[model samples]
Each structure stands twice: as structure tokens, then as C-alpha cells.
Target: MTAYESLGAAVRFSNVSVHYPESATPALTDVNLEIDEGELVLVIGRTGSGKSTLLGTINGHVPHFTGGRLSGRVEVMGRDIATHRPRDLADVVGVVGQDPLAGFVTDTVEEELAYGMEQLALPPATMRKRVEETLDLLGIADLRAAPLRDLSGGQQQRVAIGSVLTTHPRLLVLDEPTSALDPTGAEEVLATLTRLVHDLGVTVVIAEHRLERVVQYADRLVEVADGRVRHGSPAEILADSAIAPPIIELGRYAGWSPLPVTIRDARRAAAPLRRELAGAFPTVAEVAPPPDAPASPAPGVTARGLRVDHGRVRAVADVDLAVAAGSVTALMGRNGAGKSSLLWALHGTGARTSGRVHLADGTDPASLKPPQRRSRVGLVPQSATDLLYLDSVGAECDQADQESGQPPGTCSALLADLAPGIPHQRHPRDLSEGQKLALVLAVQLTARPEVVLLDEPTRGLDYPAKDRLAATLRRLARDGHTVVVSTHDVEFVAIVADEVIVMAEGEIVAHGPSADVIASSPAFAPQVAKVLAPVRLLTVDQVRAALPRNAI
Candidate 1:
């Protein structure tokens, strides 16, 4: 005889399918699923795999706001979504989109948290109590007075979660909830979500690309692909799913029975595999940088005593490094660790107190005109969509071609190479995050700068898109372009980076060859390294190459 006993399934979809009028293909096809109350579900899929489309239906955004052809029934908390628009269902469902910054309605952390409740017009005393509770629950009490824009990407993400959480909705839906967070921050958020599900009986559904951080906590896994929806226990879905974390991939590679989903589980079962490769300890020498590589080249990017500050805060302090031509350097660090600040400073953009960005060709990037600077050294910011505002994808490509002074179809050609078969007439806003990223990347690469800087380049990319991006970076490096990418994806760094640079509190703490540096830290190690530690392998392909023929 409580509120929990009254509700049936938190969300139920019966023969639901969606097709955008502008799109030739359906985003989702005949999906039928039910999420029971208090269950925690993880939605997994490749980019543009209809995961977003599925989540949108629960909160009444699919056909209501998106103007899509949605057929069938979607009921949340015993209320039909066909009749209840998002505003009407606000009390039962709360949604947090991928780009948290775009959804902000206030400047300060506390203000943003309270803004949602104010829309519902709750009593002042009730709103105050809920706001305080949400702030403490999300561990952002210290940031209440801080401006939302000034906070780190992770901080902004926390505020966004708290904002929706203040509503006390029965169901919470999130898209890429931890995409911007560091490893530690992501862990904290997941733990908080776990507590909410167990204690309050709140059902939660989340879509995430980094399955490594989320799968173990998932009560079930829901995969959307090829116009189908498959739901089952995490192990059953991941057993054959193409979209998976490094741990799952490792489990498959070694043929681990009942596949381990977490690091602890993998460790307990890795003993036999460990023994097989004992005394085969890979020498640091084997993975070390090429001996003939230049320590410092005149025609490369260099920084001397570089420092960046936002007001009185020293985001990056006195960092010195050299990026040689024809190599990719990955900047790895935790949230608010100054990786983004350093990348922006290096590219001669963002705020800087003191920094000397010396380009190889005897030019100071900061001193050049904005348009001239873009052609000489291009940058794709953390939120790539900020650079896109044209009416259609084709228009944006045309603008990039004109701006870069390249051939008319240059940008379009690059876009096709990066993301195939994207409708040129589609609005950039309607594209998935991965597709948007690919578009911006194509726009920048068309300029053909000698030095290219990308912040969180793999934020929303799927496995295949990541593979394609790796190949693109390799091609750029082969053409003698210096590529510096700041990212939290250790697996990606393993594949594309020649060097790894670890940052903390706005300074470079460790710098070495990619394989050597990644293998040294437990938190930064790729799944392959964690599984085959003694062998010093960095990727699955490396393990395949090292093992005997027909070993599997």
C-alpha cells in the first residue's frame, strides 16, 4: 500500500517503430519491450543504431517533439504516451540529453537544479528542500554558487543530472550520461544511480558508448540494431553483440566461459591465461619509441613555460612539450585535470595567461587572424556542433569547402569517407552525435592544416567510426601533420597515438611512448593490457599477432 506498489512496468513499448519524414530509413522498427519498476537497464548499440530513438519514446519526445512517424503504443507509469506529451509526463519521467550544456536554463549550479521544479510551479519550501537534497545527493554542494559555464565538463554533467533528479520522477532516462566524465567521475555517478535504484525503486534506462564503465551495474542490456531490439541479461547480450567494452572483447579473445563483465571478475579467471604467458614479460624496450625519432625538430609544434588561467584559477601551469611532425600525441587525464585547457592553449585558442605556441614554420598562432589561423592550424572543439549552423548538411559542407579554398566537393568527399550515406539534405541538428562529430571532422580536415587539435574526438563514436577515425588520423600523420587529441578513451589511444601524455591539475605528469605509458598505469591501461599484462600488449590485434596460429 505504497506508491511503489501502485505502478506496473515503469515503461512499456508495444509494436513501436519510428521513421523521420526526412530520413529514408526507420530509426527504430517494431520494438516491443517492458522495463519493470526499480530495474536498472543499460541500452547499448553502435552509433545511429536507434538507441536514442528508443529512449525518446519513453519521455514522449519521439513523435511529440521530433515530428517523426511513430506507430504503436508507449506507456510510462501506467499512462499512455500517445496522449501525454513530455510536459504532461514531466512528473513521471525525467530526461537528460547527451549535450548537458545545451539544456541549461540558468547560470549557477543551484539555479539550474531549481529551474525544472519552478516550471512545475511547486511550493517554494518544497522546491528548496528538493534542491538541497539533489545537490548533496549528486555531491555538487560545493559548486552551488559556481557558474555553469565556468565549471568543468564533468561538473556540468553532474548539474544536469541533479536538475532532472529534483523532479523526483519515477523513471529517469539518460543519453550518454557519463560521456564527458573522467574514470573517477563516471564511477561516482554510476554508484549514485545504483543507490537510487535500490533504495527508492526508481527505474533507470541509460544509453552509453563506454560499456566498460556501465555494464557490470546493468540489471539487463538492451541492444538496438538493424531495425531490431534485443533485451536480456548483460552476459547473454554481450556474448554475441558487436558493440562491447574491452573486458568483453578480452573475455571472447581468451574464450573465458560465462564471459566476465567486470575487471574483478576477469582477474579472478585470468590466472590460467596469466600462467601460460609467464616469463614472457614484454620488455619496455620492445614497446618503446623509435630510437631514430627526433627529440626536438625545428619544423614542429613546441611550447615553453605555457600557462593558462580562467580568472584567478590556474587551469594549466608551466607546461612544456614538443609535438613532432608525422605523429599523433594523445592527452589523457581526469575530469577538470586541465587536458582541455592545455589543448586549447596549444592551439592558440581559449583563455591563456602566458603561453608561447611556436609552430614549426616560425609563426605564432595566437598572433594570426582568426580565419588565417584556422587554415594554418585547425581545431575541432569539444562541442563540435557549435561550429555547425547551416540549414542542411550539404550547405555546411559547401561552406567548409569555400572557407578552406578547396574544391567544391572536397568537404562532401571527406564526409562520405568518414560517414557513408548520410542524407545531404538533412539538418545538422537532427544527426546523431557521432554523425555530427564526423561532419565537423571532415570540415576541419578539408583545410589540411599542418597541425590539427581535437578535443574529445571520440566522445560519441562507435567501434566502426572509431576505426575509421583511427585510419584517418594515421593518414594525416603519414602526410606529416601533427595531431594532438585530448580524450578519455584509452582503447582509442592504444590504436592511434604514437605518444601518450598524462595530465593532472593542469600539468603534464607523465610523457612517453603510447605502449609504455598506457601499460604503466592501471586506470589508463587498455583491456588487452589488463588481460595480457606480462606480454605488454596494447590491443586485441596485437594479441592475435603474438599468439601461435590456430591458438583459439
Candidate 2:
């Protein structure tokens, strides 16, 4: 047995099966696994692959929340999950789910952070102390008085984590906690997790689709597919995993030994390979076609003097932005900056006061019906799952295509665009968070709208999902579809956005090319952008290209 096995099994499932009330098949089937104390393990799979179900099972949520029939034993900290209530497991196991907004029970950050502690009936003084400690631990002490809704997506998520941390549970489970955060916010959350695992000796289990960020940090890797654990590792498991991170995939394609796990490792592994294959190196300098001339109306989506009022607060006032038909526009802002509100306005769902908004190339700005909007703009809402309710992935795609009146085979075509040759019959929601995101994207693209608006597309996606989404957007822009994403993923914006718009207190503070805007606003920039600032490179590929052959 290992250190994990020796910790008396923080979680144990033996021949576990879960079947929903109306479902014919089991959501989870005959599964067995063990996670011990002080271990940091990563759980990964496409949506509906049982990742969330499995995580929920550890706390008795499987049968309780979904009216599911569960068979077999699920033991968490020596307690049977099925017999114990979710509230019972709260003391030993802390869960920070993907959606922060849904998890919050209190209006203010301080109260929200203290709620878990209060649930355990901790003394008021103790709860207060724990709340302050947790706030400091996550580095969000200043936002304690802030309303949960007033904070940015990233800030809200951090508070959620702080709430769970205040309980000091032995096992910390996070399901895509960093999904809604920008690069900087993501780093902050990850850093906090790292500290908890390293300094406090807490057992951490994180189910995420973004493998790159956590792969290097994870002590163990668990991969699930078809509602079963397919891969486990002490030795590296990247080569055998279908959803391996980009650097690992790149290494596998290049046939590097001991498959690299991190970008630095990939760099070192590729150094000699590049030199050895210099004479036969494939030309990678294929520049995209020159951008089309700025049209009479500027060939873009431009919002001038836009104003949006949020209750008594004027969230976004006098904002100006432009997104070209063949380019990406990134909306950058701190929490409560009205980024989502602006995206909603553009999607014809928000409060728009005085502004002249235009969709260049003859796109009608007045049409508000679903059909009318489908022809001019495709929207992947902030929560892509808000639109998904089908029984399976194939069904969801078909439904999207049918509703949008896109031709048959549209979903399969979009799948091919995301991951060539992947099966279409798989459950759409069963895919890993990243894969589910891809399906939502495919569904959106089926409309083939000239302009695409995504609100926080990268939220809750693992690194793999982020990279794939970024690549897909780049390709879409290259193909001349206007792409506008309102996001906190600064690295994503830095890599793909031709133009950047900064929204602060519901007003446009800055607008320019991505490079100039990112340079001027380092505080809101991506981690990589901040790290490589002054030198300036966006994507990882750019960083690789700019490096000297022998730099590694």
C-alpha cells in the first residue's frame, strides 16, 4: 500500500452503481477506487462520464439530489455515503463545485465564507476567526464585505473556496473551481490549492478538464471514460490517456522518450529533436491570409457610447468596442466590471441604454427573435450547459441543429472541426468539461452565424479544453467568422484576440490591439503575458517560435 492507501482511505467505492429514477442505464457502473488522505489526485473525463457523479457519491449526493438508485458501498472517512446525509460528510469532505453562483448561500462574502463553519456549530468567535483566516488564505480579505453577486467570476469562486476551507476538512474536492477565472485568478486559486496540499497536508481531489495546469502538480492521475476508471498512474500516464495535455500530445506526436508533461519539459525534450530533424523540419511559417480590408462600416461589430444600468448602479457607461468579422475581440475586466452584462447586451438579452451598436457586413442589429439572431449571431452563453438537456451528446447536437435549422450532419461536422474522427454517438454531457465545452461550441457553430459571442467560454474547462477552444476560435477567425468572447482567460485573449476591450465599472476604459491593451494593463493580463511582458508573446507556440534553437 502507498501513503494514500495507508491513510485509511479518504474515499472508497466498491462495485458502485448509480441509476437515475427515469433512466434505463446506470450513470455510474460497477466502479471501484480508493483515495487516501494527504494525496492530491486529479479526476478527468468527458461530461457525463461519471466524474461529477463519482465526486458527488463521495458525499451521498448521487442518490439524494438526483433520485438515483445506488448499489454497493461508498465509504468516505470510514462512513458509508449512502447511509449518511450530505450534511454529515461536510465535516470531513469539503466540495467546491464548478459554479460559484449556485453554491453561495449568503449574500456577502464574509457570511458566505462563514456559513460552512456555522453549519458545524462552531462558536461565533471561532467562525469569525476561521473566516478571516480563510479569506487571507485565499487572498481575498478585501472582498469580504462585497456582495456575492457584485464580485467578478474569479473573485466569487475564490470566496466559494474560502467558505469550504473555513471548515478545515481533511479532504478537499474541487470540480473545475478555476473555470470562471482569468489567468491571474486561476493562478491565485491554484496557488492556494498548492499551499493547502503542501503546507497543511490536506488530501485534494480535483476533477478538471484542463490538465496542463494541474498535471505537473498532481501526485496521481485518474482517467475515466464510459463511467469507468480507465487509467491510473504512479508512472506517467499521459501517453496512454486520450485527453492528454497539449505539450504531452505534442511530445507523443514527435515520439519523445519519457513523454514530456510540462511546457518546460516539452521544450527540453524537443530541443534535440528539432536539431536532429533540422534538415527535414516541416515549415511552420504558414501565415494566415492577410486580414480583409477594413470595410465601409469597418467590417466588424462596434458598440459606441453603450450604457447599461444595473439596478441603481450604472455598470457599463459610455463604452466603445469593435470586433472585426475575421478577428477575435476580448472583453477584459475585474469582477463586477459588467463584462457579462455587455455580452448579454450584445446577445440581445441585457439592458442597453444609449448606444449605437453595429454589426458590419450588413448584419441587422434590430432582430431579437431566436431565428433572426441565429442568422446574424451565434451565442454560446456564459454557462453553455444552460441550453443542454438532451439524454446524450448526439441527441443534444441533433437538437441544436434541428432548432437552428442547420443542415443535417452539422453536429458531426463541428465535432470533426474540434477533434477529427471522434465518435458522435458518445454522450455530449458525459464528455470531460473540456469536451462538453467543445460540444456546446459545435452546437453554436452549427448556426454558422457571421458573428459568434461567447461569455466565459473557458470557465470550468481544464487546460486541455482551454487549448482546444483557443485553437478552434483561431481557426474560426481564420475562416472569417467574427468571434467575440467575453472572458477572464487573459492568456486566451492574449493568444487569439486581434483586439482587446477593457471594461471597468461598466465603462470602457481602454480599447486597442491585444498587444497594446495587454501591455498597458498588466494587472488584468494573463499569467504568461505577465511573465513574458516587455518581450511580448501570446500563445505557447509564439513563445516557442521566439525562443532561440539552443535556448532550452
Candidate 3:
């Protein structure tokens, strides 16, 4: 029997258009779609492409909390969402938003898990049972008592899911849920969600960027573009639609039919091509980074036995870290693992930090004035727009140059080095996520501070943008500006960092060169390393070179 016949309609939208009160552009327009029970649909789109808005409509969040103008009809579980309040719809639909921090309500995992059931007025016994079941399903049972603030990013995200699932909703909608998770964490979450669909008959719908990871699991593929449902399908949808992964794009570019959906399928379809292309093997030439310029003999920044506290909680403790005259040190941990607090402590942002944080001339970071500290160190906040308050990209860079006392347009030129071909006159908000990230990187690099700290700089960028950012970072390191970045993207660390510091439970558990540390650790390891098991090959080129010449 068809899913529609078996479980009824979980979600249906016909000619749905959502327009915000103050916005000229509609968030979603003329969208028509239906999700049947026990069906898993993959919604693919770039950032700000209305995927979030469409997903939000399933539970009446679009017109309710957002106060958007809604046209057409939205029905979930055969109930009209327009007539129902979000709280009413919450009973049938569980949503995990892109920002996990936004969805959290309580302090501890146990409290958060119990929140939905409490809202629904469930009995204590029922709530307890549901919370435990959700925790076990998500594999976060060990963290039941942990504070929401103390959990890793992946763990925190899982907790967000657990909180939502406590309601026992028939429909689950996930928005970029695995964006910040490591491969293993992502795998675990996806596996759990998959089981929930197959075993419990929950309807699953997720919007994500890493399509290759979830495409294989989705029963239906939905493409959203220009604020409309451009296409849909089980077989022909993927075959005819434009929504697919990078490797699929590569295959399409090379004119491969029956495009591979997953890596295994890709491998099979590519075997013949590999045989034909073996003689013409593509060589990934090592782009020798510019020669290491001798750094001026000036102290950059140093942290000696540093410890940070959040009230009674210690986010970072007894961590000795350093950034020399010119280098990049990447700090990696799961979310809520003290990376952000450490970055703030290094800059002395009024956070409670102990031990010693020093700049040039052995000056204590905590003692330095704000202006003096800023001149010596630059911080690019997670949101580039947070640092940008200008009209145009060029103007923002110019402002950074003036504030830093550098030559006019110096920051703009730095941006050119980081991301060429970007128009300076364009509004910073109009740029792609990667270009925006590049703009911030350029602004920070222009200050030419002795030390620079980037927090999840590549959070929203695509693969190409990531590659460009990685290249620019290497150039920055080689040029002698000590760099520190905290991120969840292990693939990025594998490519750029000279040193990788792994933190867990507010303490530095592992620290060493990237290759060695990533090779040894399971939590912070890169995707390439996992694929080439036993060996610690971090980059694709490394794997390519390591493969025996005759392996193909």
C-alpha cells in the first residue's frame, strides 16, 4: 500500500505563498507539495532559499510567530494549520530548527527533554517515560543530567531533537540539523532518524546542505529554488532535477547517465570511466604555498595554563596554548566544548579567565585596555554581519582600514587576495555566504594584527568557498600572523591547520600536529582519514597519492 493510503497525509501545501510584512521579496511563493506518512523527503536549497520558511509552515509558524502573509492552504495530519495555533500544531509536528540554541528552553538535558511534555500537560510518569525513550533513541542517555550549556555542539543538537520528540509527534521536520555535527555525530543522528521513520512510522522531512549524506536515505527528493517547489520525484525527480551533490555534479559535467546517488554507486558507475581515464589520470598538483616569510622577531600571543569559568562552570581549564610570530592554530571541539569561550578569553572579553594571556612585550591580555587590545588582536565574530555595519563591501573594508590606522582601501586589497572577482560596490548582505565570510576574513586580515582569531569562519560556505578560504588561511599563516580558529568542520582542519587542539569537558584532552592528532583521535578526525582507515590521510590528495599506483 502507498504511504498516503497507509498513514494519511502528514503535510500538504497548495499554492502556499508567505510574504513578510516589511519585506518586498516573498519567503516562499506558489509552493505546492505533499508529504505522505512514513515518507522521508529531502528538501535541497542554498541558504535563504525559503526552505526554512516552507518547513516552518507545516506547523503554522509562518503566519503565527512570524506574522507573515500567508495564502493558499496548509494541512498537517488532515488538520488545517492556519486555524490551529503553533502550540496546537506542536502536538502533531516536531521541528528542529537550524539554530539549536534558539530552540532550547531549560538548563539541563533532562529538563529540556521534559519541557514539551510539560507544555502538553502530560503526567509526570508519562513525561519521564517519553524523555527516557527519546534519550535512548538519540543515543544521549549518558548526558541526561548534563547542562545544556556544557554539552558538545553535536550532543546539544541531539538534545534539541530529544526535546522535540518528547511530544511524540507524527511528523518530524529538521532544518540543517547536522550542519555543525562531526561525521560520526551526523551519522548517529541520521541513523536514529532513519530508524524512527522505518520503525515508528514517523514522517520525516529535512532541509540540508550535505545532500550526499542524506540523499540515499530519502524516499523522495524535493527541490526548492527561487521560493518555489521547482520539481519533485522518487526516481525521475533526482534524474531530471538540478538538486544533487558535488560529486553528482562532477558526474553530470562529465556526461554520466544514471547519475550515482551515493559514493558507493558513484564508485560503481565510475569504474569504467576510471579504466578509460586511468591513462589520463588527473594530477592534483601541490600548490606550493609561498615561501615561508621570516616573521619579525616580535612576540605574538601566548596562553599559559589558561582557565575560563562561566559562573561556577569551567568552560576551559588549565589549557596551555600559544600562537607564535606567524602560524595557524585551529581549536576543534564539539559544540559547548569551550572553543568560543577560549577565543573570548584570549581577547579578554570580560569572561572569567585565569592563568596568563599575553600579547607582545609580555603584556598581560587582561591588563591591556580595550583599544590597545583590539589593535594588537582582531576578532571575526561567527556572523560576519555582526562586524559589518557599512553600506557596501568596499566601504566596510575601508572602515576597517581606517579604524586599524592602515592605509585606505588596504582592507579591500586584502579582500582581493582572499576572494578575487567580488564586487566591492555590492551590499555585504547580498553576497553569498562564502563571499560574506571572505569579506570578514579580509577585514580582519587588513588590520594585520599580530594575532587573529576566527570562530567557525567556514560555517555556511560551500565546498569551493571552503577550498578558497583554506588557501587564503595558509597564505595568512605563511605570512606570519598567528591565527586561532574554533570550528566543528574537521575537513577544514585537515587542510589548513599546522596544530590541532582537541578539547572535551572544558579541558584540553589532546594537542599536537594536525596529522598526528587527527590520526589518533576518533572524535575530531577528518572524513578522509575515516575512509582510508588505519592510515591518517587527511586530504583527498593525500589519499590519492597514498593509493598504490596500480590500485585502480
Candidate 4:
């Protein structure tokens, strides 16, 4: 009898190991695991961890699609993946990757949803019915006729998911699906997935970095780290791992019997602790800039009555802002709330109907030449690859050196500091998401511009990589550069940002110190603040420093 014929598991791996051609060690080493049918599993780990390698094994992509050496056996739905390629397993496994824009094959949403079903050679009537059903299920009926390129990041994500769901596969695999979405959109996507798991009996496997959004819905948690795999319940796995949500850390700090994964459970566990520290004020750090600190005769950059339009659409309207030298500012907002347009306007590149940007010399930025403007202001857009279009990594770095008027190895040195170990001879497209962002940022920094801007810099980075990025931004600020970033990662903002700017509907709603603004906003608050509030603490490290020895 076949193994899966007797057992109810959807996936099984036995003594599996994978080694890339250029790597020294296996990405996954001696791994044995089984995922039961109708179970929703979550995979968590640091970047370059074996999470992707493990996820790819179920569909035969690790050994078959990607040029890698595989050992041992993998079975999905009672079929050995070693003998069956991905196309043969299409009816059983459906995969969706990180970038939705790259995944879609058609220009319109409706056509993109139908393309997969057509490739499978489904009946025409069945394809039409399934396309409409998926559009309604994902709440994207309004965008059925909309062009895929024109939609916002969150909308594109919804369409991508719907396109894959139309196939009715028994096993679904998603890689960081909600990384591009806002809070509300992320919740919507998760709710849809939850329904699919419970009502349709489909098996779901997801690898995601934003644990806060997916942990509550997970039936089982699998962690890939240090060339091994660990599996347990959500609380059991997160109890010992450093990567956890704010609520989980709060439960650990209070010495609760079991870690809480949801806000409701956390509140129930913290009732006694809340009563114990009713009137206590947190030890505050000096985060806000002094009023007199930027008291010099000129500000680093100034924008007054800034207005941007896109063919009768006011993407940005009447925005005024300023930043002191040597400060790191974070721009945060919901999807489609004008954050990207504002950043582009400040860099003197996007559409500007009426606005004036002045540097310390009181010169309008719009009047400068392309070379002169780039040396003064540098921007890394959401599509970072747009800034990188060379034959190889070494070639790109060399070109950056020439454009910025820096020495021969200046860009190479900066890239090493940002993300070491990237092969110089490899193609830029072969690098991971985090590595790509680092390369672009290093190239921009080679110019030593007075101002630097990044849009969604944490899109696909893991926790360890984020820590390194935070440290680099801090160093840049100390070196007297005005750094600004547009992102939705509240945890990252807590660690790196000195100032916070909140935008809504093409206007600034609040601008102040990072600690105060983040603490006040419900949507923007970090994990630590959610649990330890009334105290206004932002990180677990701060809470540990403030608590007494016997508190735990």
C-alpha cells in the first residue's frame, strides 16, 4: 500500500536534503516532515533560511524546476514528486509567489484570472463561471475590468490570489502573499484563506515574515532555521523562538503559563498585570529632536504648498514639510493614500503641477540638470529593479562609480557593507529580494547625496536583514544625511525612525516624534505597545530593562 493511501497527510518528506551548485552546505539537511490533510501550516524563518526550499519540495520544484541536487523522497497526495514534475501535479498543488505584478500574464484582471484555467484546458463555460466566482470571493469584482498595472499594491495582491484560487487545487502554497497589502486588505485575504481551509477542505501552506497577521489563523507552525525544521503548535513553536509578535512577547514577559497568539487571549492573560501597574508611567527615552537642534540658518530640505496631479487626479495636494540634517524620518500610510506620490515629488522626478522644493542654498530643485539633481537627491522607488539594468552585479557597481564621480571601488565597498557575500559575477535578477534592495541602496549612497529616500524598503526582508538595515540607516543619519523611508512595517519604524509622518488621502494628518505618533495611532502602533500599553513602551528590550528582577 502507498504511504498516503493509509495516512491522511497531504505532504510527506523523508530524509530530504538539497544543495545548490554554488553553495557550500545544503539549504535543507536531513529533514523529515508530514503535513496532514485539511491542515493550515505556516512556515517561519530568517532570510536565506530553508523555508522556501522546504515549501518547494512538495511540488517537485526544488529538485525538478530549480537546478538543484535532491536526496530521499517527497510525496504529495500519494504521488511521488521525484517521478512527477510540477505540471503533472497541477491539479493537486497550486503555487503563488511574492511579486503579484510579475506573476500575472494578462493586462486586465478578468483575463488574468482566466489564463490559468485555460492553460489547464478546462471547459469554456466552467472557466467563465469560476472566474466570476473567484472575483466575488476575493472582493475584486470592481477591479475585474481594471488594468493590472494601474491598481495599487494591495489590489494587485487580491487579484493575484484570485487568479490562483480559480483552479480548485487541493493544496495551495503562498510565499509572503500579504507582504504588499495594508492591514485591512491583509485581514481580508487571511479571512478568505481561513474560509477555504475550513469550508473547502483544502490544504494550505504559507511562508510569511509578518507573523502578526498569520499566526492567529495557523493550525500548525513549522520553523525552518539552521538547516533543520521544527514543528509544533503556534504557541509551542513561538515560545522559544526569537521571532514572535508583540502579544507573544508580552505573555512571556508576564510569565503566563502559555503564550497568547491573539489580542483577546493576551488581554485575558494581562488582567492581573494591568491591575498591578495601574498608575505607572513608562521610562521614556529622549526620541524627539530638540526645537533648537535644527536652529541653523538653513534647513536640509524644504517643500511648500507641494501639489502633484495625474491627469485630473490629485495624487498629492498642498503638502508642506521640512527635515533637519542627520535625521531619519519614516513616512507611513494605508495603501493608495498618496505616500509614493509625495516621495517622488520631493525627489524632483514625479508630476508636479504646483510646488517648490528648496535646498539649504534656497535654489529650486526643478531648475537643476539631471546629473546635478541626482547628486543632490537620491530615490529608491518601490520597483527597485528599475534602478538596476546591467549585465552583472559587478558591472552595475562599476557604472554607479562612474555616474557618481566616486573612486573605482566606492560602490563595491558600500554594497559589501549593505549585504555581504553577494557574488559579483552573478546576474542582478538572480539575487534575492533583500539583496536587490541593498544593491540599489548602495549604488545610490555612492553619490553621497545630501538627502536619501526609500519606498517600502522592508518588502521582503527577514528579521536579521531588517536589523542590519536599521543599523545602516542609523549610521547614515549620524553622518549628516537626511534619510526618509515610506513603509508599512511598524516594528521596523519603532527601531529606526526618529520622526514619523502619517498621510491620508493626499494630505498629512500627523507629524511628530516616532514614539508619540506611533503610540497614539491604533493602526500604526507596534506590537509592544499593543500589549504593554498604558506604559507606552515600543519594544521588548525596553520592557525588559524597565521591569524588576522578580517580575517574571
Which model scores highest in TM-score? 1
**Candidates sorted by TM-score, best first:** 1, 4, 2, 3
lDDT: the better of candidates 2 and 3: 3
TM-scores of all candidate predictions against the true structure: 0.94, 0.77, 0.77, 0.90
Model 1 C-alpha lDDT versus the unseen true structure: 0.85
Question: Model 3, which residues run further than 4 Å from truth?
Answer: 1-7, 21-24, 139-152, 231-300, 309-317, 324-326, 335-337, 350-354, 380-448, 460-475, 494-499, 504-552
Model 1, residue 321: distance off in Å is 1.9
- lDDT score, residue 451, model 1? 93
In model 4, which regions exceed 4 Å deviation? 1-6, 249-256, 271-299, 407-413, 548-552
Give the distance in Å from residue 478's predicted Cα in candidate 1 to where it truly belongs. 2.1
Model 4 lDDT-worst window of ten: 286-295
List model 4 lDDT by residue over 1-552, tens digit each. Answer: 766658988999899899988688898999888999889999998766778889888888888878889998888999998899999898889888777888889999999999989989999999999998998888889888888987777778888899889999999999888887766678888998999999998999999988888999999999998669989999999998857766776677788878889877776787776544443433444322322222332367889999988766677879998877777889988777788888888888777889898876776667888899878888988777888899789999999999999999999988887777788987888676677888898899889988888998887787667778888888777777788889888888877887899988889999988878997777888777676566666766665655553764
Query: Which pairs clash in model 3?
Result: 152-335, 153-335
- TM-score of structure candidate 3: 0.77
Q: Which residue runs does candidate 1 get wrong by more than 4 Å?
A: 1-7, 279-299
Q: For candidate 1, lDDT tens digit of each residue in 332-357?
A: 89888888888788778767788688
**Deviation in Å, model 2, residue 376 alpha carbon:** 3.1
C-alpha root-mean-square deviation, candidate 4: 3.1
Global lDDT of each candidate: 0.85, 0.72, 0.73, 0.82
